[model samples]
Target: MAKPFKNLRDKMSPQAQNASEEKAKKMLSEMPLQELRKARQLSQKNIAEVLSTEQANISRLEQRTDMYISTLRSYIEAMGGQLDIIARFPDGEVHISQFKEIESLQNSKSAQSSG
Candidate 1:
Protein backbone atom coordinates (compact mmCIF):
# COMPACT_ATOMS: atom_id res chain seq x y z
CA MET A 1 0.00 0.00 0.00
CA ALA A 2 1.25 3.52 -0.87
CA LYS A 3 1.51 5.91 2.07
CA PRO A 4 0.14 9.43 1.69
CA PHE A 5 2.75 12.20 1.25
CA LYS A 6 2.86 13.35 4.82
CA ASN A 7 6.64 13.47 4.91
CA LEU A 8 6.40 9.87 6.13
CA ARG A 9 10.12 9.82 5.55
CA ASP A 10 10.38 11.11 9.08
CA LYS A 11 10.73 7.45 10.00
CA MET A 12 12.92 6.72 7.01
CA SER A 13 15.66 4.20 7.48
CA PRO A 14 19.17 5.47 8.13
CA GLN A 15 20.18 4.45 4.63
CA ALA A 16 17.50 6.67 3.13
CA GLN A 17 18.56 9.66 5.19
CA ASN A 18 22.16 9.11 4.19
CA ALA A 19 21.19 9.15 0.56
CA SER A 20 19.16 12.32 1.05
CA GLU A 21 22.02 14.01 2.86
CA GLU A 22 24.45 13.00 0.14
CA LYS A 23 22.19 14.43 -2.54
CA ALA A 24 21.75 17.67 -0.65
CA LYS A 25 25.50 17.97 -0.15
CA LYS A 26 26.17 17.34 -3.81
CA MET A 27 23.74 20.08 -4.87
CA LEU A 28 25.04 22.58 -2.36
CA SER A 29 28.62 21.69 -3.17
CA GLU A 30 28.04 22.58 -6.78
CA MET A 31 26.01 25.74 -6.22
CA PRO A 32 27.05 28.65 -8.44
CA LEU A 33 29.06 31.41 -6.80
CA GLN A 34 26.41 34.07 -7.42
CA GLU A 35 23.61 32.08 -5.81
CA LEU A 36 25.78 31.37 -2.81
CA ARG A 37 26.74 35.02 -2.51
CA LYS A 38 23.13 36.14 -2.71
CA ALA A 39 22.02 33.52 -0.15
CA ARG A 40 24.48 35.18 2.19
CA GLN A 41 22.62 38.45 1.57
CA LEU A 42 25.75 40.03 0.04
CA SER A 43 26.39 42.00 -3.11
CA GLN A 44 29.08 41.25 -5.67
CA LYS A 45 31.20 44.12 -4.44
CA ASN A 46 31.16 42.81 -0.91
CA ILE A 47 32.24 39.34 -1.96
CA ALA A 48 34.99 40.72 -4.16
CA GLU A 49 36.27 42.73 -1.24
CA VAL A 50 36.58 39.66 0.93
CA LEU A 51 38.21 37.58 -1.77
CA SER A 52 40.57 40.39 -2.80
CA THR A 53 39.18 39.93 -6.27
CA GLU A 54 37.80 42.39 -8.81
CA GLN A 55 34.09 42.75 -9.54
CA ALA A 56 34.57 41.24 -12.99
CA ASN A 57 36.38 38.26 -11.47
CA ILE A 58 33.61 37.73 -8.99
CA SER A 59 31.10 37.73 -11.81
CA ARG A 60 33.14 35.21 -13.72
CA LEU A 61 33.55 32.90 -10.75
CA GLU A 62 29.85 32.99 -10.00
CA GLN A 63 28.96 32.02 -13.53
CA ARG A 64 30.78 28.73 -13.24
CA THR A 65 29.10 25.68 -11.68
CA ASP A 66 32.26 24.74 -9.78
CA MET A 67 35.05 26.82 -8.18
CA TYR A 68 38.34 26.61 -6.36
CA ILE A 69 38.41 25.86 -2.64
CA SER A 70 39.78 29.27 -1.72
CA THR A 71 37.09 30.96 -3.79
CA LEU A 72 34.35 28.88 -2.14
CA ARG A 73 35.69 29.61 1.32
CA SER A 74 35.79 33.34 0.66
CA TYR A 75 32.21 33.45 -0.54
CA ILE A 76 31.03 31.38 2.42
CA GLU A 77 32.82 33.72 4.80
CA ALA A 78 31.53 36.83 3.06
CA MET A 79 28.01 35.71 3.85
CA GLY A 80 28.78 35.40 7.56
CA GLY A 81 28.40 31.65 7.16
CA GLN A 82 30.72 28.68 7.20
CA LEU A 83 30.74 25.92 4.63
CA ASP A 84 31.13 22.50 6.20
CA ILE A 85 31.67 19.47 4.02
CA ILE A 86 30.78 16.44 6.10
CA ALA A 87 31.15 12.74 5.47
CA ARG A 88 28.89 10.57 7.59
CA PHE A 89 29.02 6.83 7.99
CA PRO A 90 25.70 5.03 7.60
CA ASP A 91 25.21 5.07 11.37
CA GLY A 92 26.76 8.40 12.14
CA GLU A 93 24.94 11.56 13.19
CA VAL A 94 25.52 15.05 11.75
CA HIS A 95 26.21 18.00 13.98
CA ILE A 96 25.76 21.50 12.64
CA SER A 97 27.43 24.42 14.32
CA GLN A 98 25.83 27.65 15.44
CA PHE A 99 25.85 30.62 13.06
CA LYS A 100 27.51 32.85 15.64
CA GLU A 101 30.63 30.72 15.51
CA ILE A 102 30.76 31.13 11.75
CA GLU A 103 30.35 34.93 11.70
CA SER A 104 33.99 35.72 12.57
CA LEU A 105 35.70 33.06 10.50
CA GLN A 106 37.38 35.52 8.15
CA ASN A 107 38.32 38.21 10.60
CA SER A 108 41.97 37.62 9.89
CA LYS A 109 41.46 38.45 6.23
CA SER A 110 42.31 42.11 5.89
CA ALA A 111 39.58 44.59 4.93
CA GLN A 112 42.06 46.43 2.67
CA SER A 113 42.30 43.39 0.41
CA SER A 114 39.60 44.95 -1.75
CA GLY A 115 40.12 48.09 -3.82
Candidate 2:
Protein backbone atom coordinates (compact mmCIF):
# COMPACT_ATOMS: atom_id res chain seq x y z
CA MET A 1 0.00 0.00 0.00
CA ALA A 2 2.92 2.34 0.61
CA LYS A 3 5.52 3.32 -1.97
CA PRO A 4 9.21 3.77 -1.29
CA PHE A 5 10.44 7.37 -1.34
CA LYS A 6 13.59 6.43 -3.23
CA ASN A 7 11.51 4.79 -5.96
CA LEU A 8 9.32 7.87 -6.29
CA ARG A 9 12.33 10.17 -6.40
CA ASP A 10 14.02 7.96 -8.96
CA LYS A 11 11.02 8.26 -11.24
CA MET A 12 11.29 12.06 -11.42
CA SER A 13 12.96 13.66 -14.49
CA PRO A 14 16.45 15.10 -14.18
CA GLN A 15 15.14 18.67 -14.34
CA ALA A 16 12.62 18.00 -11.60
CA GLN A 17 15.31 16.42 -9.44
CA ASN A 18 17.57 19.40 -9.90
CA ALA A 19 14.75 21.80 -9.06
CA SER A 20 13.87 19.77 -5.98
CA GLU A 21 17.48 19.76 -4.82
CA GLU A 22 17.77 23.52 -5.30
CA LYS A 23 14.58 24.12 -3.33
CA ALA A 24 15.84 21.92 -0.52
CA LYS A 25 19.13 23.84 -0.43
CA LYS A 26 17.31 27.16 -0.27
CA MET A 27 15.10 25.92 2.53
CA LEU A 28 18.10 24.68 4.47
CA SER A 29 19.91 27.98 4.00
CA GLU A 30 17.03 29.96 5.55
CA MET A 31 15.83 28.71 8.91
CA PRO A 32 15.18 30.15 12.33
CA LEU A 33 17.73 29.92 15.17
CA GLN A 34 15.80 27.08 16.79
CA GLU A 35 15.67 25.08 13.57
CA LEU A 36 19.35 25.66 12.95
CA ARG A 37 20.22 24.44 16.44
CA LYS A 38 18.12 21.32 16.00
CA ALA A 39 19.60 20.67 12.57
CA ARG A 40 23.05 20.82 14.15
CA GLN A 41 21.92 18.15 16.67
CA LEU A 42 22.40 20.49 19.62
CA SER A 43 20.10 21.06 22.56
CA GLN A 44 19.51 24.20 24.63
CA LYS A 45 21.44 22.62 27.48
CA ASN A 46 24.38 22.08 25.16
CA ILE A 47 24.42 25.65 23.93
CA ALA A 48 23.95 26.91 27.47
CA GLU A 49 26.98 24.97 28.65
CA VAL A 50 29.11 26.29 25.80
CA LEU A 51 27.99 29.86 26.49
CA SER A 52 28.42 29.54 30.27
CA THR A 53 24.76 30.47 30.66
CA GLU A 54 21.54 28.78 31.70
CA GLN A 55 19.28 26.72 29.50
CA ALA A 56 16.36 29.09 30.12
CA ASN A 57 18.45 31.97 28.82
CA ILE A 58 19.22 30.08 25.66
CA SER A 59 15.48 29.41 25.19
CA ARG A 60 14.68 33.09 25.64
CA LEU A 61 17.41 34.13 23.23
CA GLU A 62 16.04 31.82 20.54
CA GLN A 63 12.54 33.28 20.96
CA ARG A 64 13.68 36.90 20.74
CA THR A 65 12.86 38.76 17.50
CA ASP A 66 15.50 41.38 18.25
CA MET A 67 18.96 40.76 19.71
CA TYR A 68 22.36 42.34 19.65
CA ILE A 69 24.71 41.35 16.85
CA SER A 70 27.36 40.40 19.41
CA THR A 71 24.92 38.09 21.18
CA LEU A 72 23.96 36.47 17.87
CA ARG A 73 27.61 36.14 16.89
CA SER A 74 28.49 34.44 20.19
CA TYR A 75 25.59 32.02 19.82
CA ILE A 76 26.60 31.11 16.27
CA GLU A 77 30.21 30.72 17.32
CA ALA A 78 29.15 28.35 20.09
CA MET A 79 27.53 26.25 17.38
CA GLY A 80 30.88 26.11 15.53
CA GLY A 81 29.78 28.62 12.89
CA GLN A 82 30.54 32.21 12.00
CA LEU A 83 28.03 34.97 11.27
CA ASP A 84 28.50 37.47 8.46
CA ILE A 85 26.51 40.62 7.88
CA ILE A 86 25.75 41.07 4.20
CA ALA A 87 23.89 43.84 2.45
CA ARG A 88 22.28 42.83 -0.81
CA PHE A 89 21.69 45.31 -3.60
CA PRO A 90 20.15 45.15 -7.04
CA ASP A 91 23.59 44.81 -8.57
CA GLY A 92 25.61 42.98 -5.93
CA GLU A 93 26.16 42.20 -2.26
CA VAL A 94 28.53 43.72 0.26
CA HIS A 95 30.00 42.18 3.41
CA ILE A 96 29.90 44.63 6.31
CA SER A 97 33.27 44.38 8.08
CA GLN A 98 32.71 46.95 10.82
CA PHE A 99 31.58 44.38 13.35
CA LYS A 100 34.60 42.14 12.62
CA GLU A 101 36.95 45.09 12.98
CA ILE A 102 35.42 45.98 16.34
CA GLU A 103 35.91 42.40 17.52
CA SER A 104 39.53 42.42 16.42
CA LEU A 105 40.16 45.67 18.23
CA GLN A 106 38.61 44.37 21.42
CA ASN A 107 40.67 41.18 21.27
CA SER A 108 43.89 43.13 20.80
CA LYS A 109 43.07 45.49 23.67
CA SER A 110 42.28 42.58 25.99
CA ALA A 111 45.49 40.83 25.04
CA GLN A 112 47.50 43.98 25.68
CA SER A 113 45.85 44.63 29.04
CA SER A 114 46.39 41.03 30.18
CA GLY A 115 50.03 41.08 29.14
Best by TM-score: 2
**lDDT, model 2:** 0.97
Where model 2 places Cα greater than 4 Å from the true spot, the runs are: 109-115
Determine which window of 10 residues in candidate 1 has minimal summed lDDT. 99-108
**Can you give the lDDT of residue 92 in candidate 2?**
100
User: Cα deviation of 93 in candidate 1 (Å)?
Assistant: 5.7
Scored against the true structure, residue 72 in model 1 reaches a CA lDDT of: 69
Which residue runs does candidate 1 get wrong by more than 4 Å? 1-32, 93-115
Task: Record all residue pairs in model 1 with backbone atoms less than 3 Å apart, i.e. clashing.
Answer: none
> Mind giving the per-residue lDDT tens digits that candidate 2 earns over 15-38?
999999999999999999999999
Report lDDT (CA) for all predictions: 0.70, 0.97
